[model samples]
Target: MSKWSGVLPRMAITQRSTLLLFALAWLGVCSSFTVIKDGASSLYFCKELDCPKFEEKYNSTAYQIRMYETSKWVSTTITGLDYQAATEEAFMKLFEYIEGENDQHVKIPMTVPVINRIQPGLGPVCASNFTVSFFVPFKFQSNTPKPTKKELFINTLGQEKVYVRVYHGFTNQTNFPKEAADLGDVLNSTQTYDKSYYYTAGYDSPFVSHDRHNEIWFIATDK
Candidate 1:
């Protein structure tokens, strides 16, 4: 059996409180997406928060295929030798923007799976670029608050298909690269993807001690 099998029951019980809060607060916005009928908590890794919606296109022992809708996100970039450090710094800046540090001073609801796109350096010792982002809640997609900080901005992702490999535990510079490399190794040879950069996604808060979900995504070039 796959490692993720039978994990959801335990996760559901543990995350009941948080999941309920997310559904009550954000379910209305996803009315057209069948989140209510399907149970939002079961359908997404972001059980306790709103996340970008996607349609499952395929799944296999190696990876899953998903087609995501065009969405908006609040993002910031940080360049450093340490991926963890740069992600943390960028996250804080984007978090501040969502917490009313913007032109409209509007407090936006936080989202799940803070994603980081990594552009590797040419040399071993060179600093890499990490762009950290939070999904913009559907309600605010059309008119997002403008960030006050020059480093923060709103980014719109066009609809696209991606190959996703899901993993467990906290994602840092070390484990993430390993996971990405492993996923790349196992991908079907016939598949085509963007090799220039990949995305790392973390779906749980630091306080969540178990059932944490992380993923690496390779944009499908053929799609």
Candidate 2:
């Protein structure tokens, strides 16, 4: 028998029910897709074209300014998985959804910097309440396909300018916050950025090492 099969029978009714609900929720998020509205464009990060437009390269330890265009995304909020595991799980599920596992049977190209943000006011930032998003390519932005599952949804982000700090090396629960705090200090000294909410963008796959790129973005509220 499967590992879960043996443990599930021994669980209390309430525990069993909770586990079942969580599993179902994850399934829904992984499988569902919603129809795109008219005139709503989808957007993706293309290093050859779009990335250069938004992100300006710099040679400072402080921050660089980036102007991002509004874009649409497919995302799911997972409550129990840690940063790495959540990202991995979310990506696979989204990949499957786009690979004809959804209601639309559409295959979409993947984009860079799979976004991971900590949900605001969600107590402390640990494993729970992390949102993982995949950018929907521009071709499908205007008329996006829907997911087959219920827990997955689409969201639109408005255009904004932000201050970003790029870093190298692998990210984890410990290092992420530390780097964020360090960036926060740099921004605090400049008094040029608004730190209300910051975003973490990862550009490389787990396999890539050496010149990996990761960034912390703080929205510019001064403008």
Candidate 3:
């Protein structure tokens, strides 16, 4: 409320706490998340109202990773960050919402790294550019049963991007055999892909397409 109240000694989240917050926010599916700050040295924030903002100061000062589970009960992975405004208060609400969703148990994960980064790409696509920011990388092994406690990463990367795409059908529905084969030709055709550069998988893009199905992507990043 007051400047003193705003600047109180109440700022910071562990990596796992970050994830718990994420799960609550994503699952609730109300608005967007925001990350903002006064300056690189200032940790205090003034969130917009209903969305998540970008805060470089958090990235520069935080020393751990923050993450949360997207609690959206989607029939599929085709979702997007359809938010309005980004503000610190909005984020506090988001985190609080997540805590409320969790019954305010404060049951955070054990492996949150100090300092966080986040670069949320728009909708439905699984693999995101967490590495692009200070957020910890989200690791979802294809087809593996969801972990009882998945690690939520923090934003460490200072970039955010918005892209769109479209999907057509179920993973094993159409002539995927031929499609995979074609894509393979392109990857191998290049002057030898640095096999170690990434781990390949099936994916679906969320944009516009004649078909309606889960999109797959060959996600790649660095260690």
Candidate 4:
């Protein structure tokens, strides 16, 4: 009888300790910071001095018209898979670079609205490729740190204007195209845009609620 009592106490203590540790880890992941700069189109991950700013150079709220004067950015491309799979894989690689996995051992501030654009090739529709880009902050744009991995590279994007249709909800493979289609219809009826290419922008973390912000941007036709 005494042998059973000794074993039960240690097992119960261990179980409780494991549960406590799991809870703490979950809370820390959920509590990552999000900082929103004034008059900016997207949110920042933390209070980073060198975070990329999403300046709204033009806004026609009356017609749901918003334009972003995006600054030059360093981006890495991921190819050869479906949209969801490619994005997940590319994000990990980019995250590693920003987490001091680069030539300079630099820790770059994370930015919002991770962008993904479809790269069409001469093949079947389902076999189409996609490119994902993370905007590097302006501070590092001049002398950007090179990624340690060969798959990742840095490139600069000059200032460009994009017309966007913003929405609030989770975006997935099933719903992303539907949202893009809806935005296209509106743009066709009310305004002029470069329909040649359109891309999606996501502005929230995976842990965020269903009411998160996302956008579909059509490169605006020059005025």
Highest lDDT against the true fold, candidate: 1
Comparing 2 and 4 by lDDT, which wins? 2
Off by over 4 Å in 3: 1-150, 155-167, 172-179, 194-210, 213-216, 219-223
Query: Residue 54 error for model 3, in Å?
Result: 18
Q: What is the lDDT of residue 128 in candidate 1?
A: 85
Over 1-223, each residue of candidate 3 has an lDDT whose tens digit, in order, gives 6786744444433544654654455444323322222221121121121112232222111121122223111011112232111211133332342233232343221111111112345445533331211111122112212212223222222222211111245333234333434434444233232222221111212121334432222222210
Residue 75 CA error for candidate 4 (Å)? 2.4
Between 1 and 3, whose lDDT is larger? Answer: 1
Order of quality (TM-score): 1, 2, 4, 3
Candidate-wise lDDT, in order: 0.79, 0.65, 0.26, 0.62
Residue pairs with clashing backbones, model 4? none
Q: What is the TM-score of candidate 4? A: 0.69
Question: Per-residue CA lDDT of candidate 4, range 52-158, in tens?
Answer: 44446545532244444455454556666466667766666676777689889977766665777766445545454566677776556667888888877775544
lDDT of 1 by residue, 29-129 (tens): 23322232232334557764568889999898779999998999988888889986687667657766776799989877766768999989889998888
Query: Which of candidates 1 and 2 reaches a greater TM-score?
Result: 1
Best by TM-score: 1
Lowest lDDT sum, 10 consecutive residues, model 1, at 31-40
- Better-scoring candidate (lDDT), 1 or 2: 1
The candidate, 1 or 4, that scores higher on TM-score is 1
For model 2, the superposed segments whose C-alpha errors exceed 4 Å read: 1-59, 120-127, 189-197
Give candidate 4's error at residue 6 in angstroms: 41
